[model samples]
Each structure stands twice: as structure tokens, then as C-alpha cells.
Target: MEGRAFTHTRRALWETRTTFETAPYGSIAAAYFAMWLGLRGIKLSAVILHDLATALGAKAVARATQYFLQSLRPEVGSQPVHGWDSLIFLIIYSVIVFLPLWWLADLRWARGAVYRYRATTRTTKALHFCAEAYSRPPGKRTSQLRDLESGLRAAENAILRAHRYAGTFPRRSPRSAAVRAHAALVAGALRAESLKIDADPNATLPRLGAMLAVIGERCAEGRIGAMLSEEFLAEATPVSLTRTAIRESVHVIVVVTAAMVAAVGGSSALRALGVNDDLRPWLIAGCSVVAAIVVGGWHRVGRLLELMPGK
Candidate 1:
């Protein structure tokens, strides 16, 4: 009966640890809500919907390419193209249309709002666990010690993840540097506490707990994640509604206009080269594929700039 009880206790502790480790994902919804609330008063621009614009631009480019190809081979235009050829074109189009959006979304800053909130929540919770452990008597501290250790580890992971996006162009801010140093301190302290606990299961972590309390206090005071306050509001660039509308209108017009011009120029270039009518369709397809790749790469590069942390 004693052995079974020990097994159950260990299993419970393991489950708690697992919960702490996966806590960041659950924190995402809260973070998103915090971010939305922060930006609620401000009018968001279509810039946030850049992925949609890129998709529309890709479609326009594809349509223009197709129109030009058909014009080049009026004789063969009547013949049904092979299924394989259409499928290949579609694959190329999809890559051009979706790859950039995926790349942009994958970047760390794309989720900065959530990461910031998670980091703050983790740090605060770690401090709470530490305080609880510190106040408890040594004889009754095993569970609290385990929870404190788990919380500290979770906080460290969250802080490091937030640290990744806490930089501006070319360099990180002083606040970010401090946060990173704090994360390193947490790592060292957690390790020391873990070693002490391994030596004696009932060991107290007063020093580690005290240190983490200071860090959490700083976080609450706007050192890291700004405690999800007005700092989040500052993250969004303030642009007039008129300017935003004009910017979006210009973006749509430019993308579509560029697509049409490129198609016309490409068709004229192929004609000047005296390319055979029989081969023009394949050549146009190849060129469209190349253009799609270049455009996708360009979009990815543009989105990568978002990785730079906002002030």
C-alpha cells in the first residue's frame, strides 16, 4: 500500500510538471485577448492583412500570364491543354500564392504579442510558487518545492522565447538585454536549487525564491512584457485612418498594375526573340514559375523585417 501511494504521488507530480511545461500554449488565448484589448481603440490598417493582398496579387499575375500565353498561340488556344500541364501550373501558382504568407507567419515576431503575455504570466506564476514555497515550513515543503522548480523552468523557457523577438533593427533594447540576463540568472538558480533538492528532497529554496521574487517584481513594474498594460498599445504604429486607406488602395493598385505590365513586357520580349508559336506556352509557363519564385522570395524577405521587436 505504501509503494502504491508513492507511485501515485510521483505520477501526480509528473502530471503537474507536464502541465507547467505546456502552459504557454494555453496562455495564448489570454495574450491574444490582452493584445486585442490594447488595440481596440486604434483603427487597424489593411497592412495587417498583407497575406490576403499577396494572394490577390498572385492571382492577378497568373491571370495576366495566362492571357498573354493564349494571345501568343491563337492556333493552339482551341486545343484542350493536358491535365498534367494544368496541374503543374496550379502547383506553381499555389507556391507563389501561399509560400510568402506561410514564411511571414512562421517568424517569431508574428506571435510576439502572445509570447509577451505568456512570458509575463509565467514569470509572475513562478514568483507566486516561489513565495508559497518560501513561506511554508521545511517539513511540509516537498510539493511546493517541486512546483516551484517546475514553475521556474517554465518561466525560463517563456522568457527566452519572448527574448527572441525583443529587439529592434540592428540591436536589442536595454530592457531586452536585462530580461535576457534575468533569464540566465533564472537558469543558474534553478539548476542550483535542483541539485540541492536532489541531495535532500526536503531542501528549502529560499535563495532561489527570493531572487525570482525580485525578477517578478521588476516584470510587474514594466521591465518585461510591460505587465500587459499601455505598453502593448504603443506597439501598434499610429497612423491616421485616411493614410491607412490610401496606403491600402495604393498597394492593391500597384500589385495589379505591375502584374499587367510584366505580362505585356514578357510577351513582347518573347515575340522579339522570334520564339516559335508551338513553344511559347511552355516558355510562358516557365517564366511564370520563375517569377512566382522570385516574388515569393521577395515577400518572405519583407515579412522577415517584422521579426524586429517594436518599441
Candidate 2:
């Protein structure tokens, strides 16, 4: 039962990857474009509101900003805009409106959609391959299975290392370090498994199980275990882990892009409305802080996703 389950899971993962790789560029492009459009809409709306508040009535602008700041409690420091006075109303209003839209479009909706799509596609392919491999006579396929298991283990180890090192190094460090580590590990594991299969066409299920146990034990001792529970490790196949990691990478990209777009739009909208000239410095500072938080949070989420079962 365990062998059958593992094979099924791997085949599913391979199928999922194949689907993603084959997807029309236009479809993916459209999804990303929609995210941008949503962000732009929010920015435009905020700008219009800011202009209306400023030109139509200063008191109205002040009241609106106050309400927004009070409600949102943005980390605006002790500046003129942060005060009860209406001077920075337009800026505050823009931020209040745009921040939520950005969050909704990028972090919540778009990210979820992307993650689910990738996960489904990758898992499908992996499981298909696993099933095919397992269907072969045990004596004929033992070596191949062993090699595959080893490759998978190596890849898993690399991914764990990348996760651990994330945010630990300086800002200027190459982004590919983590990615490379993961890739190397995956390649090594796959290579080992392939070799084993070539050497021995007929391998037993017990040997395969032992190989899995070895990898699982090593992974559990590493930082990778912190993110993935023993239950997940025991049940998950190599294909699933790889697929999950890829899906998570997509989410990170979407979320980070959305946050950046929001920051720029929010800043621009605030400036256009001329809501808080006196509190300009503080407002900028506050926005910077918020942007940092968003980016940091997005990174953490990506890491967590990578650690999850069933990529």
C-alpha cells in the first residue's frame, strides 16, 4: 500500500509540472496583467479621492484623513500629518485606500490563485510518473527506484539548506544561492536514483522503503524538519516536494510584486493630493517601514510554503 501510494504521488507531481510547463504564455500573462490592473485601479481611485477632498473642501479633507489614520493606525510618526490637523488628509486617505486594495489584489487573491494552480499542475505530473515506474516488475525496476529515491533525498536536503539561509545573509547576496542549492540537491538525488535503476532492473520494495527511511531521517535532523513535520515527510514523495517548492516560488514573486506596486502607487497618490506637506518626511518614513514589513512577511510565507507537503 505504501509503495503504491508513493508511486501515485510521484506520478501526480510530474503531471502537474508538465501542465505548468505547457501552459500558454498568454494565460499566465493575463493573470499577472490582471493583478497590475487591479493595483492601478486602486491607485487611480485614491488619487481621485484625494483631489476631491483637497479641492472641494479643506475641512472635508482633514476629516477624511483623520478618520482614515485613526481607523488604520498606520505607523505615521509625530509629524504635522499625524496630528489632528487636516493638513495631511489627502496623503493619509490615499494610503488608507490603496494599501487595502494592494493587499487584497496581490497578497490575498492573486497569491492564492497562483499557488493553487501551480500546486495542482505539478502534483499531477509527479504522481503519473511514480505510478508508471511502480507498475513495472519489482525485479526489473529496483535499481531505478533506488536511484530516484537518492536523488530526491539530495534535492530535499538542498531545499532545506536554502530555506535556512534565507534572510541570514547580507542584502546584496545573490538570490540564486538558495535556488542553486535546491537544484543541486534535487539533481543529485535524481541522478543517484537513475543510476540505481540502470544497474539493477529488478529491485525490491523493502530496499525502496529503506532508502526512503534514510532520506527521511536525514531530513528530520536538518532544519528542513522544522518546516516539514514527520508525517508529511513520511507520506510525501520526491516529486511532491519539488512541485511544492516551485509553486511557493511563484507565490513569492506575485506577492512581492504586488507589495512594491502598492508602495509606489500609494506614495504617488499621496503626493498628488498634496495632503501632508508638513509631514512629508514622516509619511515617507512610515511608508518605507510598512513596505519592509510587507516584503519580509512575503518572504517568510514563501519559506513556509516550500516546507509544506505536496508542492
Candidate 3:
């Protein structure tokens, strides 16, 4: 019976550890909210310019390539001849259709990243304060420690259950990376507190002070602390990791939207140009190539940025 009890206790601790390791959903929500506010702060002219450039570039390249291919093809039969003017018209129509959708999607993603970052920062601060308080001299310190542990356990379980739900739903994409980072910081702080508890579960004042000092120092210098500081300082300026994340998300949306517009517009242009049926495969292939280039380039750039220090 004792062995079974020990096993159950160990399992509970492990669950608590896992929960503490994950970043809280509240942090993620707040970070995204901040990003949304940042997006609103951007200049309207700049946003319009960005959209125009993307649309123009995509249309120009796609139309030019389509025309060049059409010139090489033999006139097999008298079908519909979609001239350059028709192709241009289709491109313009497609751009107008897709740009708004892309912009909104980008905005959503940017907001999410910001929310996660801010939330993590706040949670870390709270956890650090609690850890320090729990480490004070005995008497009140002991009571505080018990209360903190109890609170942490409850929070951890709730977070774990939320994480499980997040994992189960594709639409519920929780900011796992940020969550894990915060969780690590909390666990480290808790571990330091546990050391004090084991040294003198009776909660001696001197031991509590020493433990608090040591844990406080660790919390201040550890990964979580560093991340929090980085975010806080970054938010002070426009050119921070958070900004970069927003920009990258915007770029991706623009690129993907351009590709889709080009593909659809190119198809419509082909239909209008009276191009032969044999040319359909070539047109489809060309559209695929454009999409691949945009998507592949976006992926490479995002990966490179992620690999960069502080990103």
C-alpha cells in the first residue's frame, strides 16, 4: 500500500511539473492582443503601398511568362484568343479579390505572437514574486510556502488540462514554445524552494531567507528572466523581435496571396487569350511554379529568422 501511494504521489508531481513547464494560455492571449494594437498603429499608406507592390509584381511576372509561352505554341484551332489586355484585367480583378483576406490573416497571426510574449512576461514576474515570498524566514514564510505550492499545483493542473484540449483541436493552436519557456522558469523556482523544504521542512527562518535569496537570484538570472527582460526592452523600440515576428507574418501573407492571385488570374487570362487546349498544362505548370517560389522562399526566410539569435 505504501509503495502504491508513493507511485501515485510521484505521478502527481510529474503532472505538476509538466503543467508548470507549459506556457499559460492567458499570456498568449495578451501577447496577441498587443500585436493587434501594434498593427493598428501602422501607417495606412504603408500598408496600401505594400499591397500594391505585391499585387503588381505578381501580376507582371505571371502575365509576362504566360504570354511568352503562348507565342511559342502553334495555332492548332480557332479558339478564344485572350490578349495581353484581357490577362492584365484578370490580374487586376484577382488582386482586388484576395488582398484583404491576406491582410486580415496576417493581422491575426501577428496579434497572437504579441499576446503570447506579453502573457509569458507577466506570468514569469508573478511566479518569481511568489517564489521569493515563499523563501522568507520561518513562521509566515512556512505558511506562505504551503499556500504557494497549493496554488501552483491547482494552476498547473488547469494549464495541463487546457494544453491537452489545445492539442486535441487543430483550431486551438496554443503558443507552446512560449508556454514551455515560462513553465521551465516556474519549475526551476519551485525546485529551489523544494530544496529548502527538504533541508528543514519545519521552516526555519534563517534557512528560508537563504533559500529565498538563492532562488531569487536564480529567477532573476535564469532563461525566463532573460526572456522577460528581452521582451520588455524590445517593446520599448519599434525594431524588436516582436516587430520582426509581425513583419514576417505579414510578408508570408502577402506572398501567399500574390501567388494565389497570380495562379487564378493566369488561368483566367489563358482562357481569355484563346490559347489552345494543349497550352492548359503549360499554364497550370507555370502557376504552380510561381506558387512554389513564393511559398518556398517564405519558408526559407522564416526558418533563417527563427535560427537567428534572440528571434
What's every prediction's RMSD, in angstroms?
18.3, 17.6, 19.5
Off by over 4 Å in 3: 1-239, 273-311
Model 2 spans > 4 angstroms off: 1-190, 204-209, 221-311
Candidate 2, residues 1-311, lDDT tens digits: the string is 23334443344335435644334355456655775676555555545666777777766564554454443434555433333344355555455445544444334422332222332222223333344466777566555555444344333444444333222344456754544444344434433444555455346333333444433333322232232334433433344445656976776676566556665776687789786655654565466546645765633444544443222
**Least well predicted 10-residue stretch by lDDT in candidate 1:** 227-236
Q: Candidate 2 local accuracy as lDDT? A: 0.45
Q: Model 2: how far is 7 from its true place, Å?
A: 21
Pairs that clash in candidate 1 = none
lDDT on C-alpha atoms for all candidate structures: 0.49, 0.45, 0.43
Best by TM-score: 1
Residue 22, model 2, lDDT:
38
Model 3 agreement with the true structure over 190-233: per-residue lDDT tens digits: 34444556466555323333333332232222323232223223
Give per-model TM-scores. Answer: 0.31, 0.25, 0.22
In what order do the candidates fall by lDDT, top score first?
A: 1, 2, 3
Candidate 3 CA-lDDT value:
0.43
Count of steric clashes across candidates, in order: 0, 48, 20
- Of 2 and 3, the candidate ahead on lDDT is 2
